[model samples]
Target: MLTALGLLPLALLGGWSLHAAGDYKEREQERWMLDLARALSSAADAELDGTVATLTTLGSTPALQNGDLPALYAAASTLARAQPDWLGVILTDDSGKILFRTMDSYGAPQTAAPADPDSLNQVLSTHQPVAGRIARGPRGRAAFPVRVPITDAKGKLYTLTAVILPDRMVRLIERQQVPTDAIIAIRDGARATVARSRDQKGRVADAPSKSLVELMRAGPEGIGTAVTTEGQQVATAYTTLSRYGWAVIVGRPTDKLRAAAFERMGVYGIGIALSLLGCFLLASLLANRIVRTIEALQQGAAALGSGAPLTLAPSSIIEIENIGKALEQAEHQRNAQERERAQLLDSLNRALASHQTALADAREAGRAKDEFLAVLGHELRNPLSPIVTSLDLMDFRDEPGNRRERGVMRRQVQHLRRLVDDLLDVSRITSGKLQIDATPVNLADVVRHAVTTSSGQQISMSTPAAVWVMGDGSRLTQVLNNLLSNAERFGSSATQVTLTVDATHARLVVSDNGIGMSEELMARVFEPFQQAPQSLARRTGGLGLGLAIVRKIVELHHGEVTVYSAGAGTGSRFEVTLPLSAAPAPEPCAIAAPHVEGLQLLLVDDNVDAAGAGAALLELLGHEVRVAHNAAEALDAVRQKMPQVAILDIGLPDMDGYALAAAIRHQAGDTPLRLVALTGYGQKEDITRAYEADFDLHLTKPATVADLQRATAPLT
Candidate 1:
């Protein structure tokens, strides 16, 4: 019953709102239609003034009087080209024989002129400005003709100038300030558009167009609503062209106006909906309170019938107030039961944390131990890659038992020796004994020597003659050798390794068509023990230490290295930058002058066989040879013979090779003799120790036979 009471008032309010909204909307649309009609009528007046200016200019031009028909034709042509909508312009004698006419009834250029006596008769009889009936124009276009008298300087009328009105005015009415849903036009009393916008089908029917004809006939100050023959209901307004005796009528669709009215009505409907909603809310609230009171009292009665405790509600109606006191007692009992359950859950969480602590500790310890093993493996594996690549090259011998294979094996052994040397280098660097012997050196000479000595990839050098830099010759050569070796080992054999020398630094670029690296690999390629780990790397085997050493040595000389790659299959390029140095001049020293008389040479090694073998090799290069097993014996030989070259081993038993070299240099002041250290300790720091001890040259264990011959050749 309460629900029904609430709904009754809401229904009445909604109906009233809808009716009011509809009435308001109708008034608004009527106002909008009136304003639109006025704006269009005013635009037509401006067009008439523009037509007058066009005609006056053509008649007054001096070029028209000389009987130059082309000049006059050009003037008329200019006006038409400037305004495509222009119907045509005609100049005629007072008798109405056409003098010049350009109105083509068919879509063709005007070539012949024709006169109409009927049009002349009307003009003379009216003795006033006149307009002609709408006629089909070029291309079936429609236009209207307006005629005015042309007079001579003596005030005697000589010609008639008629302008066919352009149709753009009608098109302008249709598009400008006109609504798409509304149809509008400017027309004469006979009802034809001077200009028209075409319909979608390229045809505009006379029926929809007929409303304008009716409005125009009604004369100026006309207004009406009619269903156009085209099946549209529209409102039209008209005003006449006072100067031309033509009427301009504007038609707008009536349904569009009605729709606008309905749109306004919807706004009012919203307000009504809101008012009705407020009434519904008020009624619903009152009904709910009454129904709830009755429900509570009925429940209390049921509890009493069952002999159970009853609850009372605090109702303003007072009948159910005692029910609230009974409910309060029941709620208190429920709260006590909830408290006991929560206590058990909290106790369980505390026990779990204690049980998991030891397991967590054990996992962290295991992770730390694993990281240590990975670093150790990387260090051990770094040296083995270059050796593997060199060894693989050896096994590629085409024939069994060939001496060529022996040479390949020897190269692989040298590769193994280099790997061992790099390991010792890392140790020496860590112990902080790396030293530099700065000298003014010819960098171009060093480049030629390095390129000539490097074995694998195709090496080329383009250096300016006599270019120089400051660096230790042996170490600089070592730096270049390392770079060249890495390029040959990793890049393809056919790759071109180029050495470019400049004023400030030398740039070495080693490029290969072998598999390139992605951005990720290029980033870490020079990092210690990091190489491309793809199948290509397996084919182009390396421990990756060569590039790392190359980078470190270049850095040691204050230069840089940059790598570029075009991604995986494209091939990689490595650039090594080295500082430049100035060339040195020959200096006077204590050692005997260059061989006017043959200079003696001494060589030493802890391995007696290596000592004899090296001396024999030196002699083959045309150098006098003296062999010794240790540096002490080599020094004693140096004192006895004062040899021009002394080659000593670093690991000699009696004393270190570095100490012995120092003693020989001290005994022979400013010795011109080249003190070459031949040793197994070929690490970078160990070589630095040799230079510091005044040795002029440093050669590693198992140095290539060609390398030994070249070192001795300088002394000879």
Candidate 2:
């Protein structure tokens, strides 16, 4: 409302300015027309004065009574020639006859006696000057007349002269100021238009009838307003020519003023609309600033609640600036709180780190304990292998119909052998020695081989035929065999087992429909020496290292192993995913043989019994064998004999196997001898040490006769 109120004065002033300016221009136009009419009337007056002087001179001539009419006509022609402005000159006697005359340039007589002699007699009889506007008449009509009387020396009137007045006055009235759609009229006393700016049909309907007459009679100039025939308002002004009883009118349409007012109003409206729009925009911008500042504060609060970093509010005005300052103070407080929280977290992390280190150390010590047990198991199994082999031989010697006790002993010895092997594998894995002979292998073939070796009543192979992986083929086979054996032992001989292989991984899923483990037991099933239950122990009569070793081998292969079960009675699934290798190496290549023909060999053992037995075995395989009981003795023998092969034992009395190999190579002058490390401690770092000592082969104790023989084979 205030904005509208302010704009009202500006709108009115603009309209007034336009109206005043339009009126000034209208008045200027009217004055210009008046000046133009006065100029035309001045030109007409000069023309009329010259004609009257020429006519008066001709009328008072003495040639009027002379009998020589030709001489009198010549005298009149002379006078007409002297005043070129006259139409012609005429000389008349007191009788008002055309006694002498000079014709116009067109050869028409300027004055002729009227058809009514009384017309000329009346003019002469009055004996006064008679003048009016004149027009050429009909044939035999009196010539256009402006008559003057002639006087003799006695001061009495004798003759009358007539002259014609042209259409100059009417032409002057025609050239007046008038606007479009407006009429300018000059009327006589009878209200008939004597002169008009337009045709009669274009005159205004309410034009003043009496005002035009009064203008001619009572006033020199007057102005009036009226509505035109076109239904537009007009202003009419008239000025009288007092000498001729004539009036000149000037008129203009009022629409010019209306148009100017409308244009001014339009301009005002546009300006007002723009001003309001600007105000609205300013208001909106101010509101947005406040809202955005509030939004920033809200966002900051939300960030604080969600534990994200908070920022201060935006400030675009005084109120918002104050709010922003407050927010900044709060943000500073939050920062201090965050610093306190960070300190608390740091203290907790430090405590956790200390506990974690202690826990790690304890776990390492427990792993060492499991490794020691596994090594003890391997030591126990070495003696038991021969016992078990001998028992098998004894069982074979007895016939199937005889010796039932021998068969029982053979089966029991084999079970003991398996338990000892599992314990040894656990030891090897824990001690970080579990060496893998990686090979590019068709997992399908390995699965099939494991299935063939297992004694499961039902086994199903679902793996693709050509999915290849890199691993020790023999180790993978053992892993699968263990899983199958466990399934058969725990689930029942009637349980089915599955093996699957894909491009990226190989899965061995061994499920048992028979009594499965509870969740608690399944969780710990892969732990060494763990079993399902005390009651199932008899049904599955063995050490529980099978699944443990399976898990260990899969871990070594960088694979994952998981078990799933519904509960105790619903069965379980053990899934193993071993990554496929891009290229596989050879596998078990030396496991099947310990020698080739004519291969020179050396045997080193701290135990005399093992040394003699190993040398004898190498000789039996048709290779020359040298025996050394310690590292120093082996180095002496290499300096003397420079043997093509050296078998070094780690448990030597003087020096270990790896040290002995290094010494022998140094003394042998870099000769290309095949060195084999034969040690009971077959940890991964032990083999690496043997390689550093320039041994070509590393073999753990209980390496088969065939493996040792193959190690000594000639490189070519």
Which candidate has the top score in TM-score?
2
Tens-digit lDDT track of model 2 for 114-158 = 433443465587764443433234532222344566665555454
| Model 1, C-alpha of 43: deviation from truth (Å) | 99
List, in order, the clash count of every candidate structure.
17, 13
TM per candidate comes to 0.35, 0.41
Backbone clash total, candidate 1: 17
499 Cα displacement, candidate 2 (Å): 3.4
Clashes of 2: 13
lDDT of each: 0.62, 0.64
**TM-score, model 2 to reference:** 0.41
| Model 1 stretches with alpha carbons more than 4 Å out | 1-403, 428-449, 458-480, 491-508, 534-539, 577-608, 615-677, 682-700, 703-716
Q: Residues 226-276, candidate 1, lDDT per residue (tens digit)?
A: 665466777765556444554454456766656755665677567656756
